[model samples]
Target: MTIAARMDRLPVTRRHRVATVAIGLGLFFDLYEIFLAGVLGSVLEKHFHLGKSELALLLASAFLGMFVGAVAFGRIADRLGRRRAFLLSLGTYSLFSLLAAFSTGPVMLVVMRFLAGLGIGAEPPVSDTYLGDLLPPKHRGRYTAWAYTLAFLGVPAAGFLGRWLVPEAPLGFDGWRWMFVLGALGSLIVFALRTRLPESPRWLAAVGREREAEEIVARFERDAGELPEPVENPVVPAESGRLRELFVPPYRRRTAMMAVFHVLQTMGYYGFGTLAPIVLVAKGFPVVQSLLFTALTYLGYPIGSAVSLPLVERVERKFLVLGSAVLMAVFGIAFGLASASWLIVACGFLYTTASNLFSNAFHIYQAEIFPTALRGTATSGTYALSRLASGVLPFVLLPLLNSAGAGVLFTVVAAAMVLVVVDVGLFGPRTTGRVLEAVNSRVGATTDQEAR
Candidate 1:
């Protein structure tokens, strides 16, 4: 059996669960940091006496760092190894975030945020790819979705932490500083735990380190049962894929699909993410009420992810994505048009739920679609576009929301959602339950073929 077969054939085990949780926790910090800015903004605004422009610059800083990190570390992960990339990124975050706590001015904070954002940007693609490489095909879709579900917990965790800490300066330290310290400390813990995980055997073999791959597989087989006898096939050498191949046949389509998908997806995510609370305030919800309700609304993120967990394996991944996209357009429009408080809240919940489901589907899908030799690069490259789009959306989406009203703003979001439906519904292939090599082979015959 090939490495893909052995990987797919292995049963879920404690070791696999540990790896997922550790990696997922690393991603958890990333999301926490993402939402942290929103929650911490008021306090930060006061401490620095920041103007609107400076605050905007501060919020946008991390995404800029993320863009650089995603592109740079992604290529590094592909060139070096997933494990190394993972450690390097988490380490970068831990060190810089702790440094950020000592920041004296807005300029320093923004720089630190951007630097920390690099790790934040680099982690998800690597985590998703690493999980895909580790989990067998049978368990891959649902399990990875669960990992992301756990990651989404960071949203609520940040909100809750902000609520508790922001009002109180603990031990004479400001709440914001404590938040940074907590985030930094959490990342370091995950980095330490990640040391236990084995490198992706698929990546190991792809890199011409078959001995290392086989050693890891031996440990897996002890719990997963022995893999079927090996079958011979031509090896695809490490570093075989060229960067220019991104614009070629199989990859070109995926690149285009992912790039467009991310543009809309990021706009939708950050648009709603940033705008929803503001919309409430505009609609006359009090500050405390909006904060409370916003927290309530965000409950949908993790819950929605969990709701889709069972469906990951049962549903066709693309169809699930298409279905969620359809709902996002419909409900987002409804949310914008909602005048009643309950109606707006209900629609907000539904929209968030659908968004989480959509995020999970694409996270699993993007990692699944590409060949291992190019997976990190392809996934992260498009992911960087989303980061860029997200960073820019606040500028465009807020203005549209303020001037044109929610209806016009969501109409634009709905239109973007249409791109997702069109791309994945028409062009995307089935990935659930299929072997990674087989899926890659179907696309470009770029991967080593699956055993007969």
Candidate 2:
């Protein structure tokens, strides 16, 4: 049996749990940073006396940084290895987040946020790919969703912390500043935890370090104590795939599919996930009320992730993405039309839930479709384009919000989600139970023949 087949047949064990938690805990900070823009935007506007354009810039800074980080680290991880790339990404984000806390003015804050984003951007794609490399195919989506369930808790954590800390400086430091400090400190701790975890055995084997890969797999076998019969799979030659490979057939179509999915998905996902408070404030809620409502709405994130766990393995991933996108469009539009407070929260919560389902499905799908050699590069490159859209979103959406009201803002978000549905429905592959290499091999062979 090949090393990859042995890996696929292994049962869930302690290492899996520890690695998932460590990565998930680290993702908590990544998510906190992503959602921080919405929570901090109103406060910063008041504190810094920021104009609309300046507020947009502040909100977009980390996302812009994420764009650069994802693109750079994707290639780096594919070369240097996932462990090194992830550690550097987390460390860089942590250091800059701490710096962001001390900024004396908007310029310093924006710069700090942008710098921190470099780490933030690489995290999700790298982590997802890392998890994909580690987990068995049957359990892959479910466990990945498990990690995200823990990670999405950061939304409410950010929301409530903003509600509590943003309204008052407990020890004389600004509340918003304290948010950055807490996030940085928490991220550093996760970074330390992750250092103890092993690199992806699959990634090691992919890079031709079969000795290291075997050693790690041996450890997992020891830890697991007993294992099932190993299923044999044909090993595709593990040459390091280059960036240009993704632009070729099979991968090229998958890449294009994800590229469009990521770009459009952000507006719907971040529209409700990151910009909820902004929308609420525009709906005439006071800043405090907006934060509280946003926090309440964010409760759905972890819960939704949890709910998607069983469905992730049971349902076709592409269909999950499609279904969730449709729900988001519906709920987001409902949120725009809601006038009552409970109705507003209800709509917001539903939108958030659908957004996370969409998130988990796509995160797993993107990583699953590619060969491991190019996984990081492909995932991050396409994901970076999403970050670019995320950074550009506030600039576009905020202006639309100001002119057309919440109804129009979310209507635009709905329109984006509609496009996402069509893109994924038409082009995305079914990735529920297929072995990763087999999936790619079949895809490549089929596409190569078509090209002939």
- Clash count, one per candidate: 2, 0
Taken over the whole model, the C-alpha lDDT of each candidate is 0.81, 0.89
lDDT of 2 by residue, 1-452 (tens): 67899899988889998999998999989999889988889999999999999999999999999999999999888998999999999999999999999999999999999999999999999999999999988889999999999999998899999999997996899999999999999999999999998988888888899999999999999998889998777566545587777887667878888899889989998766767788888889999999999999999898889889989999998899999999999999999989899999999888888888888988888899888899999999999999999999988988988998889888889999999989987777677887888768854447534533
Q: What TM-score do all the candidates reach, one by one? A: 0.93, 0.97
For 1-452, candidate 1 gives per-residue lDDT tens digits of 67766777778988899998998899889888877776666568678998766767777788888888999888887889999999999999889899999999999999999999889889988888899889978788888988889998988787677767777888999887999999999999999999888999988888788999999987888986655654343343334757887787656777888888888787677677666766676567764466566666677789889988999899988888999988989999998898887888789889989999998988898898888988999999999988887777766766676688888899999988988788776567677887776666643343312211
Clashing pairs in 2: none
Model 1 has an lDDT value of 0.81
